[model samples]
Target: MTAPTPDTASLTSWVGDAVLAPSVHNAQPWLFRYERASGTLTLRADPARTMPHADPSGRGLHLGCGAALFNLRVAAADEGWEARVAARPDPADPALLARVSFVPGPDRDTLADLRPAVPRRHTSREPFGDEPVEEALLDGLRGAALAEGARLDFADDWRVRELLSALWDAGHAEELAPEVRAEIARWTAGVDDTATEGIPSYALGPRRYDGRAPVRDFPGAQRERDTAAVYESRPCLAVLGTHRDRPEDWLLAGQAMQRVLLQATLDGLSTSLSSQALEWPELRWLVRDPRSETAYPQIVIRVGYGPEIPATPRRPVDSVLTVE
Candidate 1:
């Protein structure tokens, strides 16, 4: 029996699922072009929305797009299509990130279990409980990252402390720089809930009472809050790295990140990202494992049970998706 070809309607649905993937500062810097006849979806970088200050080399942009690509693949599988992706297939068009071509494969069921986590996975900035993540679950997260051509390393007690210090130092540096603060301001929205993109002030989570958690300090504009909440004393931090630091490598790291995030969600874990230390070129080099500083650290993750986070906004599919 011949399998049915996916139409524009189905592709839109897949893109809808794909947009739910996380991006840095909610700066969803990606565009999707789907060709119905060839059943291929092309992912491109939205140059206009690139973060110049935080990600000068566009590493974060690629990572976030890579995450969206992973979601697209998972969504396609749920809709009964096998997605085969090729990175930067055309040299003439470097802006073209990846081209995912789909075909029918009965094995699509293998990833159907993860489809549920797509909606539930979020970046929770609040304090987490004392529950320790099991080694078995950590192993699954490593496997998930491996499946997408990236690495996830769990930081030891000492390493977590070092990372915390680095994050604190970097956050301080960011706070001091007017340009850096202004750069983030460009991507941060107020708590009014009118904007479709950027991190809203309400989703900033609770203010740090103990000053230990590695959450970013973007409370929108000049708003000041005296509110304070208890954060985890010893947070479980993990480093996501890639062997190469090229644009292509960043994209894979992003996919690996989302894969691990979804897996953690299924294991009943809440996750938040802390790339403050990784944003600065000087501090970013120190973020890797002391043993293997060669591995480029892409993002820092805080994992454990935490307060549920409200979903951040994303541009509608019609705005970011194009049909050909």
Candidate 2:
């Protein structure tokens, strides 16, 4: 028997591409259901993989699911299928995050152009170079985010310093909170970790010796190998936002976040994510630029030219996907 191509809209193949999407703590908190009869895919938040304490509100989980949804759309388009996504189709079932149907067509948003970056994109925790992100690329990123129903605002110099200070406060506060600390400890892997999930030590990149690059300190307190390096003095930072703060908003922000990231990868830029400040209620509220109309900040992104980092592990498609 020959294997089906991705254009066939094979559940297994679409899930294969979807699993590569980034999630909080590598939690990959999502499950997919494909109906062969109607050629539709349903995305749901997998409670088993959700964080109770750190993400009691389930915002992080929603973001992870949304990222997967974005990947599924891109994969479908690149494979000659048009994907129409209906978010939260069932109002009562909040866990029913999104429903996507595959239609035969050669036209969709040219976002399929970023299909290659879907696999190449990784969250680089290493230090970025001093070179600034070009304005042309920045415009493209902004457009990508806007195309996905979200806002990406590049902070001004003063705003960057302010964001850095807030992130420092959030990280310090996380250290003092036993539950949050334990959450990170549980989600992060060690030097010799062999598990298929969670962030492994090898993908932790390096410790931030200097510079305010908001790479989440996945190491917790355990001593790791010496790989400290001073990050860039003035790292480029941007905030992904939505006009509202709700479960659906977070989900949309996640899709927008991945779109911008993929565009960055295509533009030859490495990226990292920092939601530390956004995890704290007060801090998350302040992370958004006061001048902007975007009231809610979902995630902070560090974009710049840097060395390519290794890919993180993801759960097997068979583990998170079901087709009937």
Among the numbered candidates, top lDDT falls to 1
Give the Å error, residue 113, model 1: 1.6
- Give stretches of model 2 more than 4 Å off: 1-9, 107-109, 191-193, 219-224
Q: Using Cα atoms with residue i matched to residue i, what is each candidate's TM-score against the true structure?
A: 0.94, 0.94
Model 1 clashing residue pairs (backbone): none
- Estimate, for each residue in 88-184, the C-alpha lDDT of model 1 and write its tens digit: 7888998999998888767656676799999999888778987788999999998998888788889888898889888888988887887778778
TM-score of 1: 0.94
Model 2, position 5, has a per-residue lDDT of 26
lDDT of each: 0.84, 0.83
Model 1 scores worst on lDDT over the 10 consecutive residues at 219-228
Residue-wise C-alpha lDDT for candidate 2, range 163-185, written one tens digit per residue: 99899899788878888877778
